[model samples]
Target: MAARVVSPTGRGFLLLDSHPAGCFRSVTDMVAQIPPKAGSQDRKVALVIGSSAGYGLAATLAGLVRHGIDGVGVAFERPPGRRTGTAGWYRTIATAAVAEEAGSDFTFLNADAFADTTKDEVLDLLEKRFGKLDLLVYSVAAPRRTDPRSGTTYQSVIKPLGAAHTTRTLEFDADGTPALRDVTATPAGEDEAADTVRVMGGEDWSRWVTALADRGLLREGFRTVALSYIGSSLTSAIYRDGTIGAAKVHLERTAEELDERLRPIGGRALTSVNGAAVTQASTAIPGIALYVSVLHAVLGDALQSPVEQSVQLWEQLTGAAPLDLDEQGRLRLDRWELDPAVQAAVAERWRAITPETIAEVADVAWFRAQFRGLYGFDVPGVDYSEPIDPDLDWPAPR
Candidate 1:
């Protein structure tokens, strides 16, 4: 395959390398530049669930850069190819190389995070190598999960809370023309809330922590984290108040429980509600592109990428910042995403957006660029049209 070029299709889908090597460059550059705090000693080891890309990957990099922590990362991804070799895969490959060159202990485990088999392997690896883990970051997001204990599979649904929701979804025409269409989400069925919770909620996280505890894998002063989101009113019905919202609520509660459980060990658990950003996970969610772009436009330099948030989250964990908790006892890292002034401006933009006037109202141009960056496109210093050995695969994990 001569460097098969891919672009976002009508429904925001694509299967092409947007400069795979550029993906490596961006993540590698970000991770390498992370500096340790003043007079702060580096930690020993870390673990990141869902670590292949996005927040997990950023957290993994941040852990290594800022705290000089070696890490074990867990994620499931398809292998490298014209079809399967993706940004996350390339990012992981880049990470392994950096770790190796730096003589740092980094292991990338390609496996299902929800499976007991994976947990067992991680336990064994931790005991053999690091002996214990100081940090555990869970950033897994999926449409489906199979229960490791009961062997039940659950598919998560995005829907409205009470009534059906009709919203404008931004998409491109079959001919690649940007357009807007109405996307209506029906109310959830009786089992959907529970099912979404089962698949996307904190059950897996709780299981991981508890399993680690049972195996004595959690070190003293251990820390663990999971990601969550609470968008503004525009996205509330389909997100913050819907099936996924129920799951997040449960996840927050699970954080409290984990905190209590880790108290004796002088460890802590936290659910960091992150800001909205262009990620594989968020892009797959319906009816949010316009908001994200507009948020970027209005927030400007205030918009923080996963790397920025990851560093901030790790800072508090390492006592680099005063811990700020909301009334619910949760970390509100989405402070900028939900800023009253920013929200007002975004709402104005949202009300003014249309197929014809979208370019004027929202920053789709910037959003599109960020979308390309997700797949390793829109990156400098790479030739996209260059061919490669089609049989190329990720570097072996050490």
Candidate 2:
């Protein structure tokens, strides 16, 4: 495999190494080695939407590596930069290459997931390529959309609530010391909230399932899962308790509708309340960086790396029985959010540590490194000194 570069019209270059095959083999071997839980189901084909980065990308790769799931990914964004490529792109290519090396199948579709046309295209491609899909993961998080039915264009914003709140955050350089920062609550108006719902919520999910089911493309006993988060009360006012929360509620409801529709096919729809991790999506929310940084410090050795979380999600999706559900019957991987003991500890720590005392309490070193790693900044093994191609083509693996 010669080195290649893929450059998208609006996006930057993505770098591909001469060893795509080798990268793929590494991923496949990793997955093949994960011990399956007792009575785990045999792995099958899977489809992952919003599979470019963050949790979605992790989940998809994990499915391949941990559960032996061979599948395709439909991503909205291409790799960043033509030569350098985003971390997600590297992961996707690596995943596909490894699956192929393992005598399995993989594909990467670059398109907007919200559009009906995109969904149809995916279905057609799946029908022609893999025939049926056993698991479908929805992990898209778009901020704006034009409602085709209503002809309304919706945009979302992140703002604080009520009076402006001055909060302390971790300075990237200083780590544990709380940097005094003021965050104004910019509540989204009714229209904005509705638009957020339109773009980020359940409506599109329901549509995708409906269309796929109607086409008879889903396998029997299949599972469809979406990711959701309900953070702590500290940040819930901006996340689960605010405009985004409203959208998530709508998403949950959409899950219910999806469950009913999939019933006849012996399929199910579920939403997982995932544990919080550092991702581009999480960073934009007010106060999350501090909370995550703090949590990372506490978890220190105990925390599941993004790779570990991906493994957990794969187990849930491909495990023998259904995933462990919360009181609401939704899948719960709230490692940080649901642990009462941990939450109490973190809240207490948050209150006690201020700008003046942060350095003494938190692990600034770990937090900054992790933050940089989120954007492919500080990966340990990648060769940053080498010249990278700015043009790479990453079409689905044929």
Best candidate, lDDT: 1
Weakest 10 consecutive residues, lDDT, candidate 2? 6-15
Clashes of 1: 0
lDDT of 2: 0.68
The RMSD (Cα, Å) of candidate 2 is 4.9
Top TM-score hit? 1
lDDT of 2 by residue, 307-398 (tens): 56667776777664458887777887776555888788778888877667675566656665555554444445555455445344675666
Cα RMSD, each candidate: 2.2, 4.9
lDDT of each: 0.80, 0.68
Give candidate 1 regions above 4 Å deviation.
1-11, 14-19, 32-40, 81-84, 174-176
Model 1 TM-score, 2 decimals: 0.93
Per-candidate TM vs. native? 0.93, 0.85
The stretch of ten residues in a row with the least summed lDDT in candidate 1 is: 6-15
